[model samples]
Target: MIETHSSSLKTDQMFINLGPQHPSTHGVLRLGITLDGEVIVKAEPDVGYLHRGTEKLCEVRGYHHCVVVTDRWDYVSAMTNNLVFCLAAEKLMGLEIPARANYLRVAMCELNRIASHLLFFGTYGIDIGAFTPFLHAFREREMVLDLFEMVCGARMTYNYIRLGGVMADAPPGWADKTSEFLKYFKTKLREYDDLLSFNPIFLDRTKKVGIITAEQALDWGLSGPNLRGSGVSYDVRKTFPYSIYDKLDFKVCVGEAGSCWDRYYVRMREMAESVKIVEQCLAALPSGDIMAKGVAKIPTPLPGEAYAHVEGARGDLGIYLVSDGTSCPYRLHVRAPSYINLAILQEALVGLRVADMIAVLGSIDIVLGEVDR
Candidate 1:
């Protein structure tokens, strides 16, 4: 006779909150999780802890004044934000950016991409209990920030990229310094591989953990490394070819397994690709006016609507602008990639151990500034 044991009876599920203050949440994000034993049954993301209403602010500010506000969206990669906003404004006004300006924009955005990825590498390591990688990654990142400081005087929020052009050309000897940095950074990437990529513990923790299929990624609207890690080869730079990316040559890094390690490795490979792009941009940079001629202080755009997108560190960062033949945008909307990418947390967290939840979320690499904007 078959009989069910009393100990085998179903138990009540436990509900817990993971954030609103937890470091692993990566921002001010709060996650409400339902646990069956140690496994997650349901996960819901509670956001808006850092909301600043940036889109509404854009509508009230003049064209030039709005550029400064974009810096706060994804403060880690502010250059990309500045470039996207400027691109939308330029498109609406029918302005033509000079060749040199385009090259400079590409170089700055690539450098910011490297910086953002390095931060992810370090922070993800800490999330998984490896403190050493954080030091190594940050050491390299400081050098990149120094280069940015040389041009814009601010390390983090560089409001350097402007409408029709950049705020200024590279400082004297900046190109040589950047070339030197690229050389140094390439060697550091190898060290990172040795330290974390193939480490036995790291592999055990990340290799098959948090697996997501390409189809699932698409259904969830993932992009950038998060999508590429799922084996999708779509990249805004390749698909859209904005700025001077078409003029340069680089590979779009993709992963096969769609695990946490795959996402991590994709970012590592992307840093190398970004270095190649920067080297090419510096080599072929042309000389010309940094800003367009005769641009009005608060120039009005023709009545129309335009959307511009660029491959940001997180994903496809897009800006939608509506002009009513006025100096300020009538309406502005920002497509915050981090916010969109965070939606997949609910699917990814189910069936994962509470421990694995941190690894999965870290792989998404979200910044709350963008998520809550």
Candidate 2:
């Protein structure tokens, strides 16, 4: 009774939801993924889980309160958020910020960029199955927070950068503490290199995975490290030169291949460039009042429209502000880089194995707050 049965196994594409709730996702984002076996056939990112209509909210709020709302957009790098809004508002009002104030603005924003990238470093390592790097990254990040708290009482959502200038000058001991942290952070960057940046296991998962060519990247409207990773030399700071960035000397970190690893390493190198910018600003910090003189408490700029963009930690963050000769803005629209950067994921994630989904997503380093805002 050696009877044999013949059967044909059929496979169909299976659709699965990744998350608006999954921990692997950087924030509250939903990815509708279709898989055949373990490979993704198609991917769609559905954002807006954390939406609060921040741009609409900004229209009704006063100029002072608008800065506060901008904090919620890219919550991790709030100083840059504060700076872009203030720059747009200041442009409308025709106010001249002091030399010292501009230097302080550059220093604060650069320090915040370091902190934000440290967060990405730690979390991306965890996403790729290395936990020890998380511990090391946070140890240095805490020092940056300590420096921020010394200037602005708040650690995260600093309403410190304002319309004409910063909230106040950094405290007497703040510069020395920041200088010491910068010295220490540079050494840690090397430590990070040995620990995770060049780790063999990390490379296996990231290198040459989810490759986006320079033309593809530009077509998808990618920016920040993602754009630079594709060998594009377009940095808003270098091209537009807002605030004191023109005066500061530093190199733009660019990468080749446009792989997940390239994007990740570009951010790592940019931290060093940011360190140089901060050090230069601190060394050349001028003597003057932190706030501009003769600015009204309730600033009512003339009827007009002004657009201001900055090189945020994520990318080109801009504010399109329209004033109707009122304290409240007539319209406020945000060009959030995270929202733009996240769009390429649909194409990038396809053909990648399920195991690599997290590595690619984590390398994009998006904060959903900005996407949803």
Candidate 3:
């Protein structure tokens, strides 16, 4: 480890770098923390290690080509990222997607949400010293990935959603496969609850650790389950009502106290809600053009700016595009929920034991791809 003197600190505080390779970091995230013995005096996050300059990459590429780059923002929920980017591009071009395509987007996005949450649940369990739950959660998540592969040709980094609609419609038996997975998912979630949720060990480790009040969370611009876990009922789907979200029936899971457990329970309950949304979307799926009409028209539109956001697995995934009446966007920006959500770590981890660090970070459900992008 390389130690550098900071001009911004008092000499009395023991400044330590907690990560860049620590197990609880989730990825290549480095935390510069000040320690007052076992308690953290203060914490400062050192980001940019994982920066890939995805936004800058967008400036040089056409609107259609940028969708693939969005997939890398949050690798776990590539579909959700695709949906946000495509929606924003469509808005800019003033394109109208088919009703069937809208329903498909909802179904795929909700399924991906559950899959992303399952990854967090698994990784959180491993971080908290329970390996079995991680495996169990992943086992279920793999089923969802299989569904993705069936619909899209690839699993991760799927640029499935196109400028006007999805790359393709659901394959044969897609609904049946998804329905079966959901059924098994319901049972597995119960097993997970019994295995981890009420366990004394988990509760003891997570209950009061990394506690952040609702006000602090809001002040920090936290979104998705992290904000909702803090007693906020604000959901992008409920508030913004994009795509088919307004037509779907689902509940936003919230927590009373913004602790690690609150975040965990919020995600746990959210899986059920996502499952509910998927079922409704699948059942109501109309048979029509899954791909939009006039997609081959090259998407050349009048220059304008548009922003579209979706309630992704993590939180609100937003895309901002400025068009110059050309094939490419003059400016493109993404509101990465993970990047913002991870900002609370320093505030949340202060005074907590090193052991609790992983639990807190995992509870936040951050994707390093988004954080570093």
Which candidate has the highest TM-score of all? Answer: 1
After superposition, which runs of candidate 1 have C-alpha atoms over 4 Å from their true positions? Answer: 1-7
**Whole-model lDDT, model 3:** 0.87
Q: Report clashes for each candidate as comma-separated counts.
A: 0, 0, 1
In terms of lDDT, model 1 sits at 0.94
Give the Cα lDDT of each candidate: 0.94, 0.93, 0.87
- Among all windows of ten consecutive residues in candidate 3, which has the lowest summed lDDT? 5-14
**Model 2 per-residue lDDT tens digits across residues 1-373:** 7966555445788999999898889889999999988889999999989999988898888999899999999999999999999999999999999999999999999999999999999999999999999999999999999998999888899999998899989999899999999999999999999999999999999999989899999999998999999899899999999998887789999999999999999999999999999999989999889998877878899999999999999999999999999989999999999999999998999999998988999999999999999
Question: Candidate 2: where are CA atoms >4 Å away?
Answer: 1-10
Inter-residue clash pairs, candidate 3: 303-325
The candidate with the higher lDDT, 1 or 2, is 1
Off by over 4 Å in 3: 1-12
Taking all chains together, the TM-score of candidate 3 against the true structure is 0.95
Model 1, residue 257: what's the lDDT? 91
Q: Is candidate 2 or candidate 3 better by lDDT?
A: 2
Q: Which is better, 1 or 3, measured by TM-score?
A: 1
